[model samples]
Target chain A: MILPYYIIIPLLAAFLISLIAGKKDNWAVILSVIATTALLVLSLFSFISMKDETVTYSMSAWSLPYGIVLVQDALTSFILVMVSIISFTSLIFSIQYIRHLSMDWKYYSLFMLLVTGMNGVIITGDFFNLYVFMEIALFSAFALVAYGSRAEEFEAAFKYAVMGSVSSFLILAGIAVTYSATSTLTMAKVAEVLPTNDQKVIFWIGALFMAGFGLKAAAMPFHAWLPDAHSSAPAPISSMLSGVLIKALGIYVLIRIFYNVFNAPEIFTKIFLVLGTISIIIGVFLAIGQWDMKRLLAYHSISQIGYILLGMGIATPLGILGAVFHLFNHAIFKSLLFYNAGSVEMALGTRDLRKMGNLMKILPTTSQTSLIASLSISGIPPFNGFFSKLIIIIAALQAGLPWYAVFAIIGSLLTLASFMKVQRYGFKGETTVESVENKVGWRMNTAMIILAVLCIATSLMVVPGIQEVTLDPVVKVIADKTEYIQLVLGGMNGN
Target chain B: MQQNDGMTLIVKTVTRISVWMILLYGIYIIFHGHLSPGGGFAGGVIIALALLNVLLAFGRKFTSEWLNISFLHDLESASATLFLVIGILGISLGGAFLANFMNKGELFALLSAGTILTLNIFIGIKVGMSLFLVVWVLAGSKIVKGE
Candidate 1:
């Protein structure tokens, strides 16, 4: 019953903000903060309550496979908690970040709508419903990207919109093909019927889904729009887009469909492996040369996603666990890094690394938190990122795929090099230009500090008991295809 | 003859007569959406088109006099809130979210389909007001640039 309110709360807040915030910008901030905080508490409560069981709520009491259903399995709950945390922090950060912008109310409204879309994507149990929610997230993101109304922002938004619509069409085509083959739009039912379908047709549908979701995830060949779109958007928006949007809407669905829905076929695994390796190498090499701060981070997003995909491609228990854990860690540290970048931009009014120097002197909080994030992202020891990457590497070796392990290691090294460049040019030199002496806002510092602490705290999930309670269920949901099928369709068979 | 900002006298007069008919037809489509093909989205677009007709017939000056932008904005938000409230109502009645709580009247009745009628009306109003606001803002921007 609480499942729908996850979506309804943000949506209602969006409308209310639009109605009242035009004359009073503070109302918009207050409403959005309250809404996101509520969502965080709700998601945490739902996660605890449904720890070991799956809960399915059918819309309109039309029964499974007929009406839309909201399913809260282990995987959905895990992602829900991750998304709510990141979105709440980003909303809090936006309260002060958007103060000087025109149409501030609209920014809050679109931000809430984006959260609604992502939550809707996570909980939906139907294929078409997933597409609808994906559109919601995508459309809001497009608007948010263009919110700055600069020439570069508009160009980036246009490119993103065009490419995104193509991906949507591909996803729609894949959905149509799946319905024609399986005669059902429900995810669990599709999984149930998929094994009986023709292998060739299923393979073709897999290819379509890979291309579509890969585009959304900004994988190697399909990643032209990410750097521009991420770098050009406003800072808080950049955090949201880079932090959780790509994971929730793209990689999360891809993993769900490939592993749970299609049972992780050999050919698909091979494709994922190859794509993951290419994205890792290309993304790192491309990132090493950029001087623009956000663009560089945007490229690293591609590289980090490659690591997660490689982990998934290994197709083992440890591999799945590592991938899910890495996904969670990346959401935290990456958003922390973006928030750090936003603080720097707010204080200095520039994103160019060549022009920034000696930031450790004035902006102590920004520099320290960014250093933590940079180390975390680069997989330094004792941080959450290191454990996940080490697990993925070990899983790859255990799976007898040493070459993928080698690439993962190399990607981490290159990630370290790129961040070192960011630190050297952006924070460790003499003041390149006159320091603005602009004070960082308390709200922005608070959000970044919280996330920086989380980057270290989340590493505790590696403990056996915590891992059993948290990551084990998500891993089981992805690893055991039969569990998903039984959970969604077994009720009909009275099993 | 002097030139006006909008269309000619004949076009304005015809638009004035036809817009009300379009509005009525849109309302009919919305109310009968549960029994027929047209529903909230299609009917809402029709209503938006009728408002657009009014905008085209009368210039910005005339339209701005009565069709306040902020009022339309508020209407859009209110209607959206109304639709969400209807969904929440289902939860309070010991059912799932959006569980269709009301009793179904007889077939072919105007009040059939528990929450669908109320939902359609809200959607119609939301879509109509939002579209009108979009057009007004776009037109206002052009005027600003022209001046």
Candidate 2:
């Protein structure tokens, strides 16, 4: 019952805004904010209350095997919390940041649609339904990427669309193959039936999905579109894309499919390891070379995603724990980092690191919060990023993959180096502070501060008692894969 | 009204009679969707084509009075909203999202499939309006610039 509202609220907000909100965007803002806030509250409630439960809501009252079901386990709830929190803050940020581009209701409507798609993806248990929701998210993302309407923005959007289409088709193809092989659309039923089928079928599906979702996740091989699309969008949108979208549409789906549905096949997990390593090393090197502030941040998104992938690929209990924790932590600090980039971009009228001067005296909140975010991303202590990365490194070493751990450590060092460049040339360039084009608004600053606060606060998830209540359940969901079959099928009261 | 309103007289004359017939045929398909292959989507495309036919033969000037972008947009949005409302209504009345709240009626009958029929009507309206709106905005006006 509570499950559908996650989608219904944002979807209703989107249509209601489109239907009623006029050229002016005040109503749109009110509707979207209310919707997102409600979602945030609902997801948090579910995350706390349903920590140990596997609740499923069968759509249209059809039994499992025939109907699309919405499942909420620890993993779903955790990702739900991440999506809602980021979207809520991003909405606040957008109320101001998007105004710099245009004061149109269209942005809010599209924004709500994006939220709807991601929430729908997180909740649905049917593969076809997931693909539909993914398309909804992708379409809105393409439109939003081109929201600026500059030539370069359009070019980036075009590139993203082309890549997005190819990936979507691959996903659709994977779905078709799965449906044909297993004769079921429900994930649990498919999982039950897949083992009896030929082993090669699973490989083809895994390969197809990895190529498809891997492109969406922007892993090393399929990472061309991330920088342009993320950098080209407006600031708050940049945050949403980097901080939440890839993780939601990319990593979340990958985890659910690879871990839960496919039961973490060794071959695919091996692929994840290789992809993760390449993305980590190459992405940071690419980041250090970029002069564009947003572009550099975009490259870092690829690298940080690599960290999450590395954690997930390790597949041990601690590795999965680290992956899940890092997913949330990266979402917080990365969003904060993008907000900093956006605020700075607005004030300085540039995203070039060399073009920026010291912003310490001006835009104090952005610089300070950015310092926290940078330190967090660099795996400095007292912030959540360090703890999650340490867990992954330890897990790798524990699993007898010392070389992988070394690579991860090297990746962490490259990340620190890259962000140091962001700090140095971006905020402390020799160029003196001069007249600024824009002033950071309170709404945007408030949004940034919320995530910045979370950057430090979410580290509490790792505390012993808190970890049992929160992170433990989520990791158990991924680690003990067989439990998913029972949970989705009639073993638990999903209602 | 003018000599240069649209295409040849035969096309205009044919369009005046054919558009309504096309719309009538589309309505038939939508209402019979639960029993037939052509449901909301196919019928809706036909309906949009009917209106597009009007614009083709009579030009934008003739359609400007009752047919416009915003009107179609509102219609599309209103129908989609209704469609969602029907689905949500299922939760309140039938215990699940998009459940068949109303009596499903007898199979192979015109009124069967309960909410699906009503849902189809709204989908048809939305799809038709949306398709027409797309064409209207993209190439609805005069081809020559400065219209």
Candidate 3:
């Protein structure tokens, strides 16, 4: 059924790019462009067919409970689309972003491998398979983090690796325990067999997932690795990591397992709420103090992720729909911001806000894109972020969690304040004579322009009738976990 | 680079065989998952560790030529493909997605596990090769550095 193309094409590209990418760097660019573009098309196709169908592909003509499996539904297809779009834009951005870097082929290879992992994570249905993909993404991220190999970059990568390893180990252990309990690793089987009365082991598994995936998502307290890692990575990579990778590997899986497989208790709702609230309050406060451009965005990522979890934590249909909408919105604008940061770095060679002043006239496109992204992320009217945040806040109030609504609003305002600081210091001030002399690359400009356009375009997903078709099925997946499992497994048996 | 004079402990060689042992044991666990305990992930880890052991023993030069971080990479991706095919077949067969053990050939036999065994093998190869490559790249990073 060609379920594995997402994983295969990237792997093939990485292999070919590495083999043929000596000195003639354009080959690497062409390869990644083709691969990402194809992925984007495939994802769009999946989205079109996914609403009313569940696709199950078995291995070697085997059935589930005995063979490997891949399931595609509205949720998976939607995420796949998001993953591919960001990857495509990022690859475009890399053409100019990595122009000065050494070992251009290796960088491109790692980047493609990273995309493969993200794609695999979003599309895979098996629990163990998810772990394997997580490792692929994490390992690639580790290498990318240290690509610069500056003392600080190496230091940050090492920190990220250590913490990531711990998180991975926790997930490994959780999967092991879950297997021991359920005697099956497939999500369908677990949902079918999961007991209503939670045991100690179930609690342990929950804790393990919370710690492991939370670390990946950069949730509060577990988020120590985020700022350093995001700030140090090249801008496009930073965008990818913050924009899509975290949502895919961390929050998406967390929600899937919690809602479907584990059939988690009401306690999870409260736990997610507390976690989300804390992250919202703390992440923005921390971001407000950041001097580095990417670092500021990294912290806001934490705060933004808070709203997603908070919305999902409510566990209402509106809450889940809001969460999904916010997830999509965040992916677009956050990546746009990262692209803007990359453009700034490409021109100035520094992400330090203090070193960047009043260059709006010098880099008008970048300045305008940065403004749109900042305003969108801060929940300004007419952009996608505003509607998503509004849905989450309204959902919170409807769920009788009025305090969470307040926190969400405050977080949004703080996000606005922080980005305002960035706009004032980084883009609004006078361009120095030295800064004005610096030339920006065409590829970087083109990439940012495309992403900026997307930031504006994705707002259509929130349009009343439009969202019913594109976003509703995805929210239905979350709202009807029982139906999801039944549909996937039922389809697997062709019933 | 520091060189030990004599009796130096080589983590690579020892880790190789251990990785192999883990791989074989992982297979045992995965295939036996339905009747007893353990499933694809634990079993897959064992298998991956085994392959990783061989890579450690050979060093990046030999492992690079043999496992070839690039080649192992393809194996990892292909296994995921195999996994997807299995799930879709279930759909085509009129079962739900990922509906395993539907045929119910024999309960405890190796072949009886049906899709469970296939999932195990696929995960074993994917995890084994991917982890091995991760360790290999990390240890032999000096070789990977280029301009």
The candidate maximizing DockQ is 2
**Pairs in steric clash, model 1:** none
DockQ of each: 0.75, 0.80, 0.08
- Candidate 3: DockQ? 0.08
Q: What is the lDDT for A163 in model 2?
A: 98
**First chain of model 1: TM-score?**
0.98
Error of 1 at A73 (Å): 0.9
lDDT of 1 by residue, A81-188 (tens): 999999988888887777756647889999999999999999988999999999999999999999988778988999999999999999999999999999999988
Model 3 misses residue B71 by how many Å?
13
Give one digit per residue, the lDDT tens place, for model 2 in B1-147.
654987889998898899999999999999999997999998999999999998888888787664766868878878888888998999999899999988889989888888999999999998998888788777744454331
Candidate 2: residue pairs that collide? A56-A494, A293-A351
With candidate 2 superimposed using the best TM-score fit, by how many Å does residue A260's alpha carbon deviate from the native? 1.4
What order do candidates take by DockQ, descending? 2, 1, 3
Residue-level lDDT for A57 in candidate 3: 70
Residues A1-495 of candidate 2: C-alpha lDDT, one tens digit per residue: 699998999998998898999665799999999999999999999999987888888888887767788888999999999999999999999888888878899999999999999999999899999999999999999999999977889889999999999999999999999999999988888888888988999999999999999999999999999999999988778888888889888999899888888989999888888899889999989988888988988999999899899999999999999989999999899889888988898898888889888788788899999999999999999999999999999999999889889988998998898889888887877888877788898998999889889989999989999999999999999898856888889742444
User: Once model 3 is optimally superposed onto the true structure by TM-score, how far is the C-alpha of residue A247 displaced, in angstroms?
Assistant: 0.5
Query: Which 10 consecutive positions of candidate 2 chain A have the poorest summed lDDT?
Result: A486-495
* lDDT measured at residue A268 in model 3 versus the true structure, 0 to 100: 82
